[model samples]
Target: MTQTHPTFAEKLIAWQKQHGRHNLAWQVSDPYQIWLSEIMLQQTQVVTVSEYFPRFIEKFPTVQDLANAEQDEVLALWQGLGYYSRARNLHFAAQQICHDFGGVFPENRESLQQLKGVGRSTAAAIAAFAFGKRETILDGNVKRILCRIFALDGEGKAFENQLWDFAEILLPENSSEMSAYTQGLMDLGATVCQRKPNCAICPMADICQAKQQDRIAELPRKKSVKVQEMTLYWLILRDKNRIFLQKRPQKGIWAGLYCVPCFENGADFHNYLRDKQMDFDDLHECATISHRLTHRVLEIIPYECDCKNAAFSANFNENDGIWVDLTDLPQYGLPKPLQQYLA
Candidate 1:
């Protein structure tokens, strides 16, 4: 509760039983669903993920189903969820679990951690939520809470591990309530002990170290990195009333999502479009969108082309591009840039 006082886990967990996210759709006995939700939640907001979670579970209800699914299909289901690697890794991990763990998700923390993309926080989440293991969690929320509560500063990759150790120390011996404790600590940071925290309702309000020091806003941060720069040219060619959409390859970024044929600045995007087999009479460059990635910033230059002298009966290659009906755009998941062009 304080820099001097100890063991805040019990109080947080106790508060959690009465005031946490209990009605979330993923709180159940199924390990696959819990694991999938945790994977999806990494660096993704719960509000965005909430819409996809139920649909995902309904589509691939079991680990084997997910494992057996085409990589593109999985990526399609995870379109717009960003951090595409999570979907890829989830598929790889499911296969491993099926082959090695009898088509069942591992129950304990150690085994779960061995699965692909199952890092410490994720492993602890699956263990605690599914098997009620008392493994402590130190996700982004917990790290922020701990860093502020201790008035801690400086970036340490090992800081989360250290915080987990502290969390374990603070955990009650009864240990029957890990699910509540883990979720509660996260929710407290999310709702009460927030970035601009409303400390009045915080269970640790009277004793939080950052509050005592009057430095709540600047407790947890790392040195900032340089943002990468990218420039893209998007060719949104349309025939009749259908706009062009291409399926990205299954390996790179936006894999399995639809896009207008695009190229980065270093590459010849105009030349690439010229090589395409389309009957276009006009090309107009629309305004650009500044697209940001975790490591790079992209300037998307959209070009609108009106096709003529072409029937709606030609097929093309090197161009996975299709003429999708604008009215039915939502039926297929296009990459964000295409969706933005439509918008």
Candidate 2:
């Protein structure tokens, strides 16, 4: 008799049972925690999410608790986590669940996808892990895994559609195995099938088409990303123990966060000061800082000034800026670099 081997899903499920991450904080069968973890994991590392997840759950243990909380509180708790939009969406989705889903998480992928920030892969993961539904997840890690396993070479919607189809086809026949199989794909990609994959230790090494074809490095094609650079000038006005901060606009980078007044350049800052007829001859240029975002690098230049005895209360009121006590600065949501600078 010819030797028989387990199918891809069987091998993955077996590997996951023995070696996958089971002690993760969000591994429980709670949809709320699973959903929150999935959203946080997008474009972020597992280690980072692990740190944030516990604090978030501690603050809002239930979806209703999250829904009732203020946006500022949510954003403040989500501080230091880049991509503030995810925090916003998670809050919004909680409200949606309470109002639309009757405070219960949707049981299936399609209904779950209706939640803001919950995409197809996220919905599938939530459904599988929380409800033991037969679903497939094709997140970045799973996409890379699929691309390498099948020796796929393409990019754009067509390539993504192919991956999605493959993802659906690769689902284990038994619904009970969905959770382990899904986690297996994530664990395999994150640990073994990385950019520089460790093929020797990979359970799917024998079956991976890329390994057989000697194209593991070339299987998953990625587009080149150019990181743009920008310069921002911040005015740090301090009066005694209080520092001035303005709420950033609701759109663009660092949206809905509190920061010192920012300008595009020195000329802009000078023009703004002139327009407001505010002059402080004691303005001192502070050290410049560079903050790197996913697609852009910001060079921040800060100008500090002591505004003691200068009554700019009326001016600040008109500009929606507030003087916050240094001791109470932790109450507000601030950009990571600004938080570091202030610290």
Candidate 3:
């Protein structure tokens, strides 16, 4: 008998069955859980999402439950997770599903894309894992793997379209194999074909064009990013066990989350205290906090002031600010650094 080797899909499926991640919290077939996991996993590490997944599911067990809850509550549960827009979008999408889809998840990739935050790759992943639909996912991880394997270079609309075509062409033949195949791609990209890949153990090592050409490190072209710097002075006004917090604008950094009143500079912060006729001597400067976002680095200087004897202006209303009890802090969605400072 002539010896034969397994095909690419077959090898990946076999490897996934033997060595891929199988014990994740969102590995179940529930579309709600899968959709939630997919959204959370975007721009976040698996280990981080693993910790938040069960807690979020516990808080809102069903699509209807998530939709019925207040946005503040949803944001509270998603407080520690950066990218506040994802939480907002998740809430809006849950409501959309309840109203438009009758609280049922769409079974196909096309319909899943109608959700606010579900992109092409995310929709494909949800359709494949939850409904057993044969769909190709072309997320960042898959893109890196494909780029290396094909020795592809360049990044533009053309490059993206090429990747989508390759992803679709590589789909497993059987619908039953979609889940494992999709997971295999994810596993291979995340563990084996990472930024610093371990090509020795990769199933694609033998076939990768980049490895063959000694250009594995140069195949996937990286776009240069400019990280901007910002500085903000935060006022931590405390009256006994209660702290003053203001709601951030509906757009921009930390949007819709509660945070201590922040000014662009120390002068503005001092002016606010002077305008309120509050004594500046009571203020204590806390250590500066440096928080880094995807493309911005923030320097936060906190000023602690005891406002036990101070009276706010009559013009100040609930919309401007409110005093929250320290014990009830968890109920409000606060920025991670601010939350930590308060804690």
Candidate 4:
């Protein structure tokens, strides 16, 4: 009888057991932590996510706790992490789990996918890590690993479907191996099989088509890149020691985050001040702030205006906005650029 070589899942599991990240802050059976980590990890590097995970977990601790917290609190913790929508959805999903599922994260992938911000890949991750369910994940890291392993071409929908099929096929048979196997693929893609892979130590290097074909760099075809630029004006209105901040509407860029009064242009700011008959002095133009997002570049021009009357109040309550003392700036959830401006 001839001895058989171990399969892909076997090699990956072995590698994971020996070298993969085993003690991440969120690596546990607690669905709340898993859900938070998965949401945070999307489009974010693990190192960055690691820093935020502990602080968030320390604050929330449980799904019910997260659900009960105010949105502002959640966003405050998620301040520097871009993509504010993810934080919003995480809060919404926690409430949904509490209201709909009795505060317990659903065990199955199908049910998990129904929650806000919990898409196919994230659902699969929660299932595998939290519930020990056998599911295949096709996140960016996994996609890169699989594409290199098979030397896949094109980023079309059909190619994506093929990758999913491969992911499912490669899943291990034993349910207990699901966590290790899933994490193995993630670890490999993130560490060993990255864009510039360290093929020497990659357990799958021998079987990776891209490595064998001398096309590791080209296997995962690049997407077309386009960047758009936008411009806006902001007013840093100050009354003595307090700065006025407004909560943005909850459906667009930087939604729900605190920001200074913004307008289409400096002319709009001037017109608003004139119309309100608000007395101000020491009005001076500040430096232009350039902020870069995934696909958009924002050119923000700020006008610093000091109210002449120390007794005058914007009088905007919490429902509209607030006059935050500069000393208490850290208590509010602000967009990165705004935070930088204040800092």
Q: Which candidate comes out best when scored by lDDT?
A: 3
1-343: candidate 3 lDDT, tens digit per residue: 0112237788889999999999999999999999999999999999999999999999999999999999999999998988999999999999999999999999999999999999999999999998888899998889898888877777999879877876777778899999999999999999999999998899888888789999988878988999999999998888889888898898998999999898987788778887777677877989999999999999999988776564553323486699888999999999998988877
Clashes of each: 0, 0, 0, 0
In model 1, residue pairs whose N, Cα or C atoms come closer than 3 Å (at least 3 residues apart or on different chains), thus clashing, are none
Q: Order candidates by lDDT, high to low.
A: 3, 2, 4, 1
lDDT of 4 by residue, 259-294 (tens): 988876667776767765654454688899999999
* Alpha-carbon TM-score of each model against the true structure: 0.88, 0.94, 0.94, 0.93
For candidate 1, lDDT tens digit of each residue in 249-306? 7766576677887777635764565556433345686887888888788888887777
* lDDT on C-alpha atoms for all candidate structures: 0.78, 0.88, 0.89, 0.86
Best by TM-score: 2
In candidate 3, stretches whose alpha carbon ends up further than 4 angstroms from where it belongs are: 1-6, 265-271, 279-282, 310-319
- Residue 252 error for model 4, in Å? 1.0
Between prediction 1 and prediction 2, the one with superior lDDT is: 2
How far in Å is the alpha carbon of 296 misplaced in model 3? 0.3
Among residues 3 or more apart in sequence or in different chains, the pairs in candidate 3 whose N, CA or C atoms overlap within 3 Å are none
- Please give the RMSD to the true structure for each candidate, in Å: 2.9, 2.9, 3.4, 3.3
Candidate 1's C-alpha lDDT? 0.78
